[model samples]
Target: MLCVLSLAPFSSPSQSRSRSRSQSRSPFLPNVRCLFGNGKQLQEKRRRHSKADAISTQEVLDLFDQLSTAQNPPPSIYQFNQLFAALVRTRTATDNPVFSLFSRLIQAEGISPNDYTYKIMMDCCARTNQVGLLFGFLGRFLKEGCKTNVVVFSSILKSLCWENRIDEAAIIVLDKMPKMGYAPNVVSYNILIDALCRKGEIEKAMDFLHDMMSKGQEPDVVTYNILIRGLCHNGEIEKAMDYLHDMMSKGREPDVVTYNTLINGLCKNGQIDKAVDCLHDMISKGFEPNIVTYNTLTDGLCKNGEIEIAMDFLHNMVSKGHKPDVVTYNTLIGGLCKKGEIEKAVDFLHDMMSKGREPDVVTYNTLIDGLCKKGEIEKAVDFLHDMTSKGRKPDVVTYSTLIDGLCKKGETEKAVGFLDDMMFNGHKPDVVTYSTLIDGLCKKGETEKAVDFLRIMLGKGLTPNLVTYNSVIHGLSKLGHWKEAFNVFRELVERGFLADDYSYGAFLGSLCKQGQSKVVNKLLDLMIKRGLKPSIFSHTS
Candidate 1:
């Protein structure tokens, strides 16, 4: 989560009361303490403890217990607020425990929940995705006559939006909030707009934007950024750019986030050069591109087969005092591997380690996959050992890549050994692993063994996907098992998989080879009825 800058520190009940009293005092004695008795001391204590380092949830509970047993009969709200803040910062599960703590605070300590208390509870609801609990809390808040400020309402709207309950959020923003004497602010508008855009309802999002403008609410940088990102996500880059122009015309300068969104969209849409132009434009606009900006451009260039240019951008990033992170190195390594530059990719890996940027599992997986595809299976196997020895465990992808390479090299028995090794290492073979091995066995004229593996996959409760079924059908057809092939094809259709051209061709060819002309004609008619066109290969067979 990105941290927003705030002029005031986190407010507690005591601090708020002190602030209210201070506001009425004369300007000449700004530091004069209007707070009396224990309240002033409690506020000072909270100020001192609030700046403490993050503490665990258990520590928070312990502190609460200590305060409860203290010479003071009831603990200050500021102390509870500090504990709550610490609990939130520690990323502890704050739902039930927080509710229990609040119950104790209200029932036993007789402490009234303040605005900051409600805000913290709402935040907990949002972070834990307990929007249902938010409604319960709101009812209690209203019953207690707690003011529903914009911040609290925004938190509720944000939680609803996060859960994709945009309709409920919209009702709150458009109707319920106004009825409660709270107008939807720019933050509330942005939350709903972002949600709508994420759900691909760009038109509805635009309607809300226009409605906001009509109500005399100026769209801020966040509002424009959300719309641009949504437009880019929906592949409407041209429209996104138009919105960018509109944003600038409305006197809202595009920020780095705006340009980064455009750059990512352009790259995904295969407009790398245009993305580069956007980067340059951002630099000229006095926006120092952050790591995200540089990483986005590097990935775009790498994906477009512009590896050399991507590397140059990396150098530029370093010269500009931006250290390349793991993501930056991974993108470049993946590009190098894709271009069959395995050696160069390895060199980059070493460079990354020398620079104190350790290669992760993704880094090793990319290089291993590249080596396997390049038919250097031995080197790939060695690299897998090196990865494990360096405390980087090989995932399914790493093992699967090596198994596939071994199978493709006609080393089916060796691939089977690796499969056992994979299982021993606590990695279960997925559909891809089984399909690869099945195909390799069939290609080696071991259809019986392939069928056995198929049964084993089913026994393991793995549903065979399209690729798996297609490979089996092709294998059985090649081995002159037309009846078995036809049965598998029928099962494929029954399972809701569309029989593609390869499927039809395989069955048609097998029937044609067996002189089953009647069966072939019926199959052809069925293919046409299913809206699958039999290719020339099917007819020629």
Candidate 2:
């Protein structure tokens, strides 16, 4: 669909000629596409004709031949620019024939490239990863005395940024093209700051911020948001908060995004009280809570074990004329499910349906998980049926949850059956899916089968994690396969796995049961030397 939408303009000479004649015509035929996702059958029909995604190289060359070799006056440079722009929008496709046509047209009768033409070429160069060509084009753009604008400077900075050569971009903006009499503006600084922040170079981004201020270009809301988000994302919540105060001191009032970033950060850092206070502060400043604000706050409360408060927050959102969205409902449902309030969570599901809020995979997964945890496996399976009937295909997590529940119920065979069912439905088992089965089989004393499955997991190129490895070790050691246990343990050490409490406990428990007290003591000494003190549970194991 994306490919067709992009290539419709330059697919044929007739279409290109028609476009040349009537520049105002939109490429999308309204008769063919009235509204996106409206006519599903028609959309599929159009998608099947995806061969039209790329314009034939011969067809484009023929169009150029007609333009360059014809007796008629050539198309206006503006028309040529339009063609280049359209071709660039198609992801620089068509074997990148635009550049050849552009170069050949530059030598044609009465045709001259305009500033827009140069800009289009710059965009093409950026898209094609031809940075050296981009600089060459930039020099020509200046040598030809084409008018320089913010877009041209931005093109260079953005092109360099795209190639991840930020230092060069930064220096070029200050060092290159001084004759053009241009300096980096606030937008330019913001672009660099944003790039730095996204790369988690927060210190460098801050340095850019200081440089921007020192150069008399003030940081705007975008500048502050980028830095704050970077700080928060890197778990520097304290630094993010300091910036929040700093932004206010500099008279850059917080926006919804600012509040949401801080709130999410505080929630993640387990500072729920601060997150709540941030909400109050936002509201007191006359900022009406949007869906994102309410949803973030609700999720924060739920994660902090304040499900009742999240419930109240939902009512508050509705009372304030903000309808609870699917996300809002899902968060509350998840919180209720976590509290073992399955009945209330189901009530929310009904309420959500009544309110015309469709339940997505997450909504159903939460309910299914809640049912599984409550040992109502039948109801959970019913939820699976309800999900498929409603046209939402179950994801890996959904089937894995079912497998986990069945295993917990000691029905390992039934759990194993789900692997076949999942694969038959075109969902290959992921690491978690296979790990769950391996753990279940091990717990069921099916060590040989579990070991075989582990081999299969590796055959499929899946790296077994600590849980998978520990599960195998526990199963083998429990059944007195100490030799195999030691082999597996050696492989784990070779793979650089530090022995966790579970790993130590598995060996200690098995040896203790076999009355190998001296071996257990030596292992304990090694564990203590590695700073892993055994817990009561570890000894019990």
Candidate 3:
């Protein structure tokens, strides 16, 4: 028999002890009285039921052994089956201690992992971010003389691209593919195109798309989906819609994902009416709206300040047997935060927690950002402390948002302290983080400190962007350090870093402001020689 304990609340520890003493005085079987007190009977019933339902780990092992030791394996005993069995045993078995059972099977039973088996392993590795293992698996597959097919490689290609292993993925696609009896298919091209688009190289993706069509492979629904999603993500909404229309012209029915992606893009870009119309179109096309469809619509509605409509959609989702997951909650919280409804968002957070769902980092960050926006920095900091107390580590966004808030409040030193704390927390600052800090410093007449941060960024192998240089140049020029600023401008040009109109104008205006007419004319001549046309303002000034 398992012993269970449930302590009841009392006024004080002494009072609880006295109550226990009084209970013991009245009962002949004091332990029994304690066991059956209050809701203990129901707890005991559950305990008994749990014991009855328990299955031993040894029993599960024995059953698997029986299946493995069959006289003849199933006819469909593909290598994929072997790898899949290994994955299942490794990932799912709570009681199974030995995961190397498959290794023993291969050695004793002579069953080897097949091509499909290797593909599944590769795909699994990709999904789990064990992408480094994929190359070794691929090498093993080639050594085994197993042919690689589209079904086998597409998923691997996708995994590589998803993990930002684009260059390595490209080598396999472009150079090694033909030798391995594999040709670029629509899926292959789509993966590359999708990766390019993700990195904001839309022109490169489009060029590759054109090359793909020229190579005699017909683009399919998956191809269109990848392109459409990429275009929409890059804010080319008009072009993305054109692609959607193109899908119809090609007699391809748009899948639920296709509609949801476009609708989400529309909603994110604040085209709520268009998003609503897209929803109607999805319904009119006889395509059933899934949870994603509802959630996207709800998020869009919330973003558009249609909270009532969004809540109604949430209700509709449950009515149709669909339940919102963590993503749904996150999106709603984020939308509400964006609209300055943090109090309502906090209520939703409490509601979610009561329902046994935990708020993730995004949820906390959203609430924290909203609080900071309302100038409730102390409350925001309290929420952050609460997050840490709950054992949730703060990510870059958490630190970045707080730093930005601090900078906005003229708390530069505090912001720097937070930045230092972020480094201590093992989170490297991004470009945006640096930009914000630099801008803040420049505003507070801490130009030298800002330049120092910029140098440190570059020293850490982070690229100094146009914004970094522009900030430094502007700050130096404002301090009447014309020579130093001009030196930077010359270095930027010499390094082939493209300066925007503002940077160009600032540099030219500084020269003109200093009454260095000769140097200004010389700089204009040099600019024209470099094929950069002087703006009318620059020329006149």
Candidate 4:
């Protein structure tokens, strides 16, 4: 028989002993009964339950198995609940093992779950993104005569929002919730609003906010923050500001998150001056600017070709006791590289290291790419070696940058060598790498080798994009390989890639150069039929 023990009403050791002494003195007393058999046995059961609760799920399951077959009485519902809670808590994958456990608890163990059990199971369903399982559990809960409450529906709504099923979640919140006698709370509305904003549905989110207010629900700071962020993301900065003012007017002050959202939006939209002004306003409002605010402003200045000003901002940020992180250094390095200022970028790299901030792969890649762009391939190669020596493995971007640089400098053979090295290092060369080498070989008058590379690319199950095909076709046409070029052109058309002006121009030019008047006239007719006028170069050829 299962020796079920109630989980509550555990007495302290001193109290148990005191009660034991009193019971021993008056065994005939009306209210002097031991509900737990004895004080010692009660403490033992409490100890066992505590151990079960503290151990891992697997260990608890093993203990349960031992209790089921041992000479001692079987474990209680409290122990089973502890095991179920452990299982729900420790689960990491998408699969819902709790459902199966629940069935075992009913059919095999003959144990009924309490409210805590149902709540934890619902939490598990939501955390694991098992929406279907959550609904199934809800049905079973109602069928078992369990009273429905806000927490249950809230868990379901949270799961729906997590899965991005906002429309269905909205229906449940605005319609089904009230019908079921459970009014949707501010938290429920906030979940739906955040989900809508994430999907770029700013207008729908606003309507929901207004609906919430019409229902006499005062929007909290969280509510205003969501609207501000959504508006900022959608580039509706003016509206976001209006709401910020409205939020303050409603006696709800904007938080750091609200100001940061506005600053990020302004920076992204290229209104750096306004972002700076907003930053000052934030300071005046007694909100300390965080690292994110500085990073956004610094990045915006760099992107707008105001690197010197951006550097000044970086100095000011350091003066404010804000440390420059990897992101800050990387952004500055990339900006300098973009302006062909590799030396200054390198100086910042040194500065970053001196400031006790380690340079990441992005920092190295940006520097390498800059050096390559400036025709400093040797220096780039040296940086590559330095990266490897420092135990930082170069990724595909690193190899591709080096290969492209070599190709541009007419070192196609070395580029191919780098490709082989990249593969040997377990980094697969992507389309850009292949296309760079192909274009390099084509420009070097090695069309046949380029064709071989294309064949290898196809063999690897990588479909050549338009740029690849265009490069090959142009190469073959320049070499007077009219038939092969035409075959490639026909393949391009058959593959459903639109033949642009460059495509038509190359094909027509080759045919014209060969003096193939009949074929040329037919090609011209097809181009005209397709509403493509021949380029001046194609006509001259």
lDDT of 4 by residue, 266-359 (tens): 8888999999999999999999988898999899998998899899989899899999999999999999999999999999989998989988
Global Cα RMSD, each model = 8.7, 7.8, 14.1, 10.4
Error of 4 at 525 (Å): 3.5
What Cα-based lDDT does every candidate model obtain? 0.81, 0.80, 0.72, 0.80
**TM-score computed on alpha carbons, candidate 3:** 0.61
2 versus 4: better TM-score goes to: 4
Ranking according to TM-score, highest score first: 1, 4, 2, 3
* Candidates 1 and 4 compared by lDDT, better number: 1
Please say which candidate is ahead in TM-score: 1 or 4: 1
Per-residue lDDT, model 4, residue 265, is 90
Best by lDDT: 1
lDDT of 1 by residue, 1-541 (tens): 2122111222233443454455443332211122212455535534544543433334444445555444534456765775565455445354335666665666544567787776787777777777777666766676667787888888788889888999989998899888989888899899999999999999999999988888888899999999999999999999999999999998999998999999999999999999999999999999998999889999999989999999999989999999999999999999999999999999999999999998899999999899989999999998999899999999899888888999899999999999999999999999999999988888887777887898899899998888888788888888789999888899889988988888888888888888999999998998899888888987754
Per-prediction TM-score, please? 0.87, 0.76, 0.61, 0.80
lDDT at 273 for candidate 1?
90
Tens digit per residue, CA lDDT, model 2, 1-541: 0011111223344544555455443333232122221446434434543453544544445445455444434356665665566567664543588777676666565788889998998778777767777777777787788887767777777777878899987885566644457767877887788888889899999888888788788988888898999998888998998988999999999898999999988888888899889899998998877899889889988877899889888888899999998899899999999999999999999999999999999999999999999999999999999999999999899999999999889888888898888888999789998889999999999999999999999999988899998999999988988778777877887888898999988877777777888888988898899899988756777
Write down the lDDT that model 3 would get: 0.72
Candidate 3 stretches greater than 4 Å from native: 1-106, 109-262, 265-271, 277-288, 303-308, 318-323, 508-514, 527-541
Number of the top-ranking candidate, with TM-score as the measure: 1
